[model samples]
Target: MLKPYNKKPLSYAKQVHHLQSKGLSIHNVAWAEGILAKYGYYRLSAYWYPYRIRSGNNVLDRFKPGTSFEKIVQLYEFDTELRLQIFGAIEIIETFYERN
Candidate 1:
């Protein structure tokens, strides 16, 4: 089943503003806007999900204290690089099995 996306689209600047409103500490506005433009809000959102404030079983939209946008970007980069390294190892293992 499909549901409607009722939220309106925001510009890169608005996206950064939204993050700030939600308690995300962003020192580099230009870089943050550029990242939003490049990777987009949805793609980068996963990285920030963990920084959101939690209340029991429910997760709040706002971030925890001192949650920085730089940390989110760093996490995203680390995860991406880690996945690439894992895949490279997996490919080697697959090749080894194929050669046997």
Candidate 2:
């Protein structure tokens, strides 16, 4: 049988607190909360995963010392920009192909 979903929702402050407790430095709490509210903690987790330190059990519960929330945001922004550029390029190529 599958286990029941028992995860509780966290407030923006709690989310920021959790990330801080995990060694992530936030330059601006409000800004970080806005980002978290917009993209969500789980989605942002992937961006921050690279800065995390691997534990003995292979779990990434802690971040490397000096890892900043801004850095993770930068990575997320870069990914978003790259995706937009790729899509634009594909659209151009498709339009050109259709014209020929």
Candidate 3:
């Protein structure tokens, strides 16, 4: 059986606070909130996961010292751009195959 989705929604400010509590160094609150509002916490988590410092059993619950929000944003933007490029290439391939 699957578990129910009982998680409450967090405001952008709360999200920033959560990251701070986990040891992330956020340089600009407004910019981080804007990104959180746009891409959402869950979506952006993937980009920031690499910066986390895992120790013992709580591997997913902490971040490395001095991990900045800007770095995560840069990773997210790079992933987005790479996805677009890959999609464009796939489209071109499909068109060529269709014409053959």
Candidate 4:
């Protein structure tokens, strides 16, 4: 397992740019991709992008009686909490973004 570290706060754009740079720096192999993809912090913006680009097609689209943005936010919050419970701290994973 990877050792944990203190996380520094960063804006969304900064984090994404850092990850893109890190991804490009490594060898283009499945192991590398797997290792990189395992960091959930790097995927946060990608997860939120769909909602940003198409707010109308969120989970609401699946149901005839639609849902609200607040519910989507709650779902994301719950998902993050669950992932943290299953893995370790989100801050621990987020720390890597600052390193790059």
Which digits, one per residue and each the tens of the lDDT, describe model 2 over residues 1-100?
A: 9999999999999999999999999999999999999999999998888888987759678999999999999899899999999999999999999999
10 residues in a row with least lDDT, candidate 4: 60-69
Arranged by TM-score with the best first, the candidates are 2, 1, 3, 4
What do the candidate models score in CA lDDT, each in turn?
A: 0.94, 0.94, 0.90, 0.45
Question: Order the candidates by lDDT, highest first — what do you get?
Answer: 1, 2, 3, 4
Better candidate number, 3 or 4, judged by lDDT: 3
Candidate topping TM-score: 2
| Collision pairs in model 1 | none
Stretches of model 4 off by over 4 angstroms after superposition: 1-63, 89-100
* Tens digit of per-residue lDDT, candidate 3, span 5-88: 998998899999999999999999998999998998989998888788877755667798888999988989998999999999
* Position 73, candidate 4: lDDT: 41
Q: Per-residue lDDT of 1-100 in model 4, one digit per residue for the tens?
A: 9888878865544543453443322233343344334544444434434443234545421212232323434456688789878676667678878898
lDDT (Cα, 0-100) at 82 in candidate 4:
95
